[model samples]
Target chain A: MPPDTTTVAPQSVAPSGAPASGRPADDLRTLESGLDALQAVPSTEKGSVRRILEGVLPPVLLLAGLVAVWQLYVVIARPRPDLVPGPLDVLGALGTAWADGRLQLAVLTSLERGGVGFLIAVAIGTPLGLLLAEWRPLRLALGPLLSGLQVLPSVAWVPAAIIWFGLSDATVYFVVLMGAVPSIANGLVSGIDQVPPQLRRVGTVLGAGRIQLATLVVLPAALPGYFSGLKQGWAFSWRSLMAAEIIAMGGTIGFGLGSMLQQSRELADLGSVLATILLILGVGILVELAVFAPIERRLLRRRGLTPGGIR
Target chain B: MSAAPAVLPAIRITALGKRFGADGPLVLDDVTLSIQPGEFVCLLGASGCGKSTLLNIIAGLDAPSTGTVTVASGSAAVMFQDAALFPWLTAGRNVELALKLRGVPRDKRRGKALELLDVVNLADAASKRPHELSGGMRQRVALARSLAQDRKVLLMDEPFAALDAITRDLLHEELERVWRETGRTIVFVTHNVREAARLGQRVLLMSSRPGRIANEWRLADDGPRRIESPEVSRLSIEITEQLRREIRRNAA
Candidate 1:
């Protein structure tokens, strides 16, 4: 990323002009205050106008380009109407699904499964991460196993989960957990690892006990890492939920895009299958925009980790 | 900012010695010092002179290899170069955190934190996060947070080295004043001789490798002694001569 070259020259935040400046530390206090004033505000205002335009214009052009290419491809392929539904046709399917109420149900079911499983994964992963990162003996014994599990594909868990839980929501949840727990734990571990030692020493000098260390020092220090893990864990949950839905094949499962595709495949309706896949993609992007991106932006904003070093 | 008044000697380190490995170099060799209750003392030396190690010992953050360190009152808090402020905390909350750990009441903490920030002259930006602060601002907040310990001693390790010249100069004055007003003992370490001279009531100079106190000076009764002044230059030359001999001996 190009460093945001924006400048925001804030007059010192001390509206009182300066602290009682005659004393030694008081002058230091005034200077410190001035610097703090600079800190509390960010520099984004400088290039925000240009940035807003830059951000908006290019994505619009990219979408237009994508649509144009799709149109051209359709014109060239010219498949039979039932075989090749255009983007409009898939959108129409989306509309019908919504009108039929099944879309809401399908989405709700998938989300419920992903959400519950992801939460459980985080709960398990956080402590597991703490152990993996802090407890040398435990980490030594389990670290490799945890790492190996993350790389082990979610699909590999489906067969085992089917055998263990046998086709209910439990099966889907089990698969999701299996897929995500490792990543969550590992994310936390890495977060803990990245925290500078100096911060930890601060905790010690502050007389932090074990719980205090974890809550105040370790956890906060690992936040950016934890958030990143959560993002990845959610991805895993959604992906694993889809996999389990497709393969488990035994539930009175709702018409989630995953199941919808399975049904469409069984009936050999390629257009519906394409529509279902597109629906899933759209939902993922929408959730990312509405949920995760906002969170990431929020975390970044609080830290004034803005593009410009405002002060 | 050097107005922090001294009530008592905040810290006294006598014949303090440290040696890391059995067969290796001595880190701090027979160092003796006393920090007046509100004095700003900077330990000026290159990387391995045990400047930080000595501060660590005084802060009671690390045990000394030998000798005794006695503090007049509460534990000394350390301010690291990176601000070392908890990122999870808002700037106000970070200060409050120190109070909380020190057993300051919950209700009292917020008010006290504001007061401390006001003392540091950063009362307005309480809610800002560390990431929101610039490099210099973060260190200032770090200073505030350390001060929140209510301890009479504050040990800083090259805390302003990372900041720019303008910010560094401003902080030096800030530190000076904080020490004076709060009457807290401050033991700051920096490689910068001027900074040591600028802030310290007395600067303790050290030679490298097997670090030893090469020289010391009392800046009291001096009228804004410039680093280039005859007195400052004489001391620097003497210390540098000692440093040169040590380096050459090590090379040999």
Candidate 2:
């Protein structure tokens, strides 16, 4: 970016105690100056493969090792092969189920229920949270209830949802809503609560009234909290959907992976049940990796909230 | 929009009294100050004194308990010790928020923001986030944002206290230059005696807790005086001794 520092005056204040060999955050002013001379290149685009290697490699290796040891223990204990299914047997069962198209449909159905429930949770929970945050009297009256609602298991809501909405998609959605919405709303409420009073004053002094302050300063600062809530809400929604599927009997809300696990259990097929469980766990991880993790990384990076030289 | 700007002193504090609460002791007591247009006044004191409290009152961020702080027209813009640059925005855009608030049209805000960024010699760092920049650079961006308000008065609360000596000194020069160029009345608050000496045209030194103006010094020497200038040194020592006496009296 710079061939010579002879005549060109450096602009902007240098970091404290920085020896600018032009290299920032290190010893050497000339290098720091060289670094300053060197224009900061835009960050490289993070590829899916690179992100996967970054995210999946460590956890995947650990989980694989755990499973391998567990499988070995089972093989040693129950040589009858009834209690122990080797790794290949589970993979082969997964293949066979996929070949039969049951696996895809079940996975797709679960995704749909989870996705719709999550979207609804965000829509309903965000506004409710904002309202609860803005209105002190209402928040005082209902805030404890909201917190209590989050702690109550989603499984607990299934019976009540079934009683109200019957055996239908609506019933499953209702259970998911009950399970997920409180966390999302509370996250926003707490996020709004934690917004610095100084920022609010800045907003107010700049001609912003109550609504604008909430929309501009209050909402953005609350984003870190909002994202965390969304992550937790999705976890709750997925779990709630599975619980709802298990409890509902009469009307077929369609077959999902949870139902397949139930079917495999009734048929006494341990290998198939175990395979279904792996698929559920794999999907859970993949969605977080594919969707939420990237966003979280980006937000953290923008704030310098993430440490450097960790790669 | 059509009314001509009011020509009164940029900020007028009449019989100002502020307390933490109704039952609490007065933090600032019956203080009356009138900041004329384009005047640069430094409120100097030790930590926990009411210098910051006074600046806040002038900015209208906090209300005075028993008095009115009236700005002739347009609200006062503030620069805090922390950059307070809203980490979410780029350096330029942080300044742009002020323009947006002042009712500058959306189309024109970017240009004005850039122009102000140029004023603080930070045009190169316009796109950088607050966290991306170093401490001194962050404060420069903050100074740019404060300038963008285009108000008659700018209230700064120890804006450079967190920075290092070199950066702080550099900013003092930049501030003096900006103060002259902008011709806006400035009420700068700081606990550092040298800093008060360096920047202030008239330095008002406050005593300890339940802070009040113990003495006011009128510096004959002009802008960017050395920290060790005879007049500046003499006044600073005199003020420091008085401040020390005040603190020691309380302790005894």
* Best-performing candidate as measured by lDDT: 2
TM-score of 1: 0.84
lDDT to native, each model: 0.75, 0.78
**Top of the candidates by TM-score:** 2
Q: Predicted chain A of model 1: TM-score relative to the true chain A?
A: 0.80
Candidate 2 CAPRI category: incorrect
lDDT at A310 for candidate 1? 20
Q: For model 1, state the Cα shift of residue A237 in Å.
A: 0.8
* Per-residue accuracy of model 1 over B1-252 as CA lDDT, tens digit each: 777554556787789888877766788888887777667677888778888888788777778788989887857788887888887679899999889988998999999999888766677778877777778777878888888887777888889887776677666656765775677777888876556655677788887766778777777744333333455444555544555565676666
Model number 2 iRMSD:
12.2
Candidate 2 per-residue C-alpha lDDT over B54-92 given as tens digits, one digit per residue, 9 for 90 to 100: 888777777788888888766887888888777788898
